[model samples]
Target: MKQREKKELDTSVQGIIIREMISHVTSEHMIGQKIKNGELRKKLVEPVWNVPDGFLLTEIKMEQFEMEWLEPESCTSDRVLLQLHGGGYVGAMRNAYRNFAVVYSELGHGMPVLSIDYRVAPENPYPAALEDAVCAYRWLLQKGYSGSQILVAGDSAGGGLVMALTMYLRDHHEELPAGLIAMSPWTDLTSSGESYQTNFEKDPLFGKTKDSLIYNREYVGLEDPKNPYISPLFGDFTDFPPMLIQVGSYEMLLSDSVEVAKKAKSQGVKVRLHVYEGMFHVFQMAMKLMPESRQAWKEAGRFISLFKDET
Candidate 1:
């Protein structure tokens, strides 16, 4: 095993303020309420509905879900980013993701992005979201985009789905994308990582609950939590594309990114694991307001550049 190196970010005032805001608003009760109330969840994320200027969003109707194409006005690259939004398998794609998709395109060096509103749990459980993701990928392929011309990216549960999607493709002998970018990915549905304990008090969003399944039960249903499709942390990374995994030091899912990096490296996959000190979960979403978030997206752009010609 290679000696693990740490990449830390000195928390900025904006980062600290955002952390406190998240901590204040994201109580266990709120989480539970959001899970049970779809309208409430949608309202909670209403502040992030603003999509920056210089981007065009076109909604495409899929057989079972809606996929949005977010393209920069100056887009020149043929590469496409297949984005999966994070809401713990219960949240749908909202304006926040539409904004993030814009960032993905801008930071991904002008590559257009296709963001999906994959089916969520409680209404549509396992295989539903996975199936929707597969449909989006196939749509890209059918549009003449080769596998190598695409990069799959997501955050939180969506991050885990990125791996699950890749594994499904690999297992089924389908072409895989050129690379992956996951932000604070919830790769372990079983909540087996030590960070759940160590960072309990430190995690602002989900620290109060030791039971990770509080956010996962509806999705897992009766299925095994360790099932690779549900928890990619337990899956094989052999032959997987180069991946960039980013997580925060204060989030409970820190170990999800850490352990997955170890797992992927062990299987000979190229992986870059970045741990931002004093940051919270999925902080990259604040790229417009925080320096660290901007830095993270800059790193993503660098990573994407490496495979620009892989197609």
Candidate 2:
């Protein structure tokens, strides 16, 4: 029955189906079994090569910032989407998220996308990741970009980073962005969501396994896991810009996404939440294989298109 469903999903959203299956079989089950395992990181760091039109693709390195850029070809000036890739906070890189950026860059609004290569945990923890995200955003501002033309985006851990970054900037009185996008963000390191328990085995992508939880513990260390920066769902959302959050119905972080959106709404922040039925985490990348993923990507592209005139 699982194989039949996999085959059906493969016909629609192949990239997600293949990766999720591999992650479940290889990284998912093996997560907590061993003391030292780089398998999850290895699998998550796979290269992404697809590039879109209307942009120049390149890499940049500064003393304080290092990242890959996707600049639209026809637009002499454009807004920026500062993206952070997710891999349980210890894995994955900006390159791994290139395809998602491409979808937004060309298909969405032809805006430039700059995906940051933030430091991972164990080697660099807590504020290190937050600092990197801030530094990258500052770099763009220094390059003459306006806050009103910028958008912060991420998936899973990166999604959490975007929310934290917004809070940090607010606390520092820095100018806020025009908008934000969080795709199945892991807003809670504490994994207190009911969905975390309910969707454990039902979801093929991830669950509250002992091993993955260990990685979360290492990332949070002694800090209160519910700290707004660690879990932005707990933060003050006043004056936040218009935002969009997409979540998978089957994901453990489903509640996190919903709570964040609900909280944002209560604070009067314009928030749009799209709960994709039968989806797992970060399902947009699998558009190459799955129709659902393709539809999700198209939806993202459409949402981003609304901002093209803002820049």
Candidate 3:
């Protein structure tokens, strides 16, 4: 971790971070190579980390990736939240993203969610993840949902992928989702942001030299890291969808979200960016007892609702 500026924190949030989370979600288990993809994935999707009640969870095999569905009993069967789980481009998505998937299902006015388990780094590298996501979108269309009925969303690297996938779709003249949700998105794989070093120690999730050097290389392989598909901060947002960008002020990727929102807004895309004070990377996942997390979800729900009438 790098040095960070002093932060003023919400007392309750501090307590939750120190008491409830620190024990298990250490840096080693998060951004480091020590991450146990299989074990940690299961732990995240545990029933204990659920959303509003009366939701059903099921795993399904998709055309290009495995996926888990989180459907509320009263969900809009035709509308879907297509989710990409973040793991620095190297994490498992199925069990890992299930908790947040359920939350999105409840908050998007009971919109069903399909969280894709895309191929990750070191093995499937580069365009593999994006390819799988694109396949998932096509699968949704095959099921009869129009483009306007879908919302593309992701957290961390998945958030970056949301931008990449949406751009790829538009470039290829494929149907586009109504909007996008990026939670602490890692838009800059180049690690060029000041916040990368500035917010390091303040962030409980990552390590600078190690994670940046290793995982980024693993994901990029021989590709140029600055390429938009790899580092979306460098991408143009001319035809981007309505976007809601959420980030923790304390996370190193804060600049990544800020820059993305700024660029998208400048391009006349509807953009809403919410920076939570003293929060960590993808803090939205801590919806269990965090008021801010709930508030973020509420904001996301509202954004998701904006496209409801179109569907």
Candidate 4:
């Protein structure tokens, strides 16, 4: 791993420096870099470090394909939480997101977690990723799990996927999950949010740039990026499940979460928004090192525990 500069090592600037190093090593911008260098892709197979004790991992097959499943030692309830890993619709797999899911499952006292290995972009784009999620949840239901027993969750692009899946279900009148939890969700693929420009310099995850917006165009292919399925912030939130949204103050998608929350509230959907200061996109990923990451998980644990009580 390339070391970041001393000045850039400050936690406030750490996100920016990480991008600088990525750009330096891979010679590509952040948006396009994920696809070219497989930055997030290559890490997906690596086993998660620091998983809590007593959580057993198993590999389960779907249609002759396998994905990771984290089975906890005990179940606070009969529910399962399905996680969609985020890599801007182009990267990430079950292994990459296992740590958070496993920890959440463990914290919730062993609610089952089945994180998907959904198809990614450039190779599989647009509805391919969305369809895979829908299919995975449907498969789970076919296995006898009710919709109310599932809580959908993800971070960044995966966060967006959860919302999209809910919207898809609402559109088709199919069974949707009980609730959703998103971390720094990239809800507006059109990149029209003012935060995209206002937070450009401060947001190390993604700055305001037409280049970053191009990723959406590439993934969605000139389709209306504002389509409800493409941008859940632009979708109807009425009758949707309760949502817990957490976002860093400096990310370009900050407004996306805020706007989504506002809409969810307007539509009478239960919504809670937690905005952290001096944080950068999906800070929870650094749980072992970052204080904010720990706090984020703590909050997630509390929120997720509610489902068990309800059951």
Instruction: List, residue by residue over 97-184, the lDDT tens digit for candidate 4.
Output: 7777777676667787888888776677688778888988887898788888889999988898899999998889888898899999
Local distance difference test values of all predictions, in order? 0.85, 0.75, 0.77, 0.76
Query: Can you give the lDDT of residue 307 in candidate 1?
Result: 76
Index of the highest-TM-score prediction: 1
Off by over 4 Å in 2: 1-38, 42-55, 213-215
Model 2: how far residue 306 lies from native, Å = 2.1
lDDT of 2 by residue, 1-311 (tens): 69647554544345455646745564434453331233446455355665654557888885654789887777544677889887767774845488777766666456778888887776777877889999998888998888988888898889999999999999999989888899999888877878878877655555545455323566676788888888888889999988889987777789889988998999999998988776777787666576677777777777776676642
By lDDT: ranked, best first? 1, 3, 4, 2
Model 3 Cα displacement at 274 (Å)? 0.8
Q: In lDDT terms, how accurate is model 4? A: 0.76
User: Model 3, 1-311: lDDT tens per residue?
Assistant: 32332235343555346433642455453433334232253245534545457887777886556877779876655678899888877777544477777767767767889888898877888999999999888989998888988899998889999999988888899998989999999888887887887876656555333444213567888899999988888988887888999997767788899988888888889999998876777777667567777788889888887876443
lDDT minimum window of 10 residues, candidate 3: 33-42
Candidate no. 4 TM-score: 0.83
Query: How much lDDT does candidate 2 score?
Result: 0.75
- Candidate 3: lDDT of 221? 86
